[model samples]
Target: MESIYDEIEIEDFTFDPVLQIFQYPCPCGDRFAIALDDLKDGEDIAVCPSCSLMVKVIFEPEDLEEYT
Candidate 1:
């Protein structure tokens, strides 16, 4: 099975603090934007608006540098 990162094609990613979200374009033709609160404890379930796909993301404190 392909990983979520592989499915999303997230490279050189960045975050938006004003929105409290992480924005990245996905390979599946959707822009995957996740809220900071959603990613608490390194795991979150998010819905993709373009593809109507559900995604599970695992995060770490290091991954949230911008939000902090």
Candidate 2:
């Protein structure tokens, strides 16, 4: 039951330039979010603030260069 909701590519997430965070749609009608810093640190999980659902972000470190 603790497993992730899904595996989503980082490219599928919307990046907020100002907030420097990536977000994806959550089934709870909210969004799952992960900080750019967290991704840079090799963290791959994005969590929904409105629920317990989470997703594993699939991306390579080099893929984040453009966003930086």
Instruction: Give the top-scoring candidate (lDDT).
Output: 2
How far does residue 33 in candidate 1 sit from its true spot (Å)?
1.2
Q: Which 10 successive residues of model 2 have the least lDDT summed?
A: 1-10
For model 1, the stretches where C-alpha displacement exceeds 4 angstroms are 1-12, 54-58
lDDT of 2 by residue, 1-68 (tens): 56799999999999999999999999989999999999999999999999989999999999999999
TM-score of 2: 0.96
Q: What lDDT would each prediction earn against the true structure?
A: 0.59, 0.96
Assess candidate 1 and give its TM-score to the true structure: 0.54
Candidate 1, residues 1-68, lDDT tens digits: the string is: 43344333223345776887766665688767778776755545555567755555555566666566
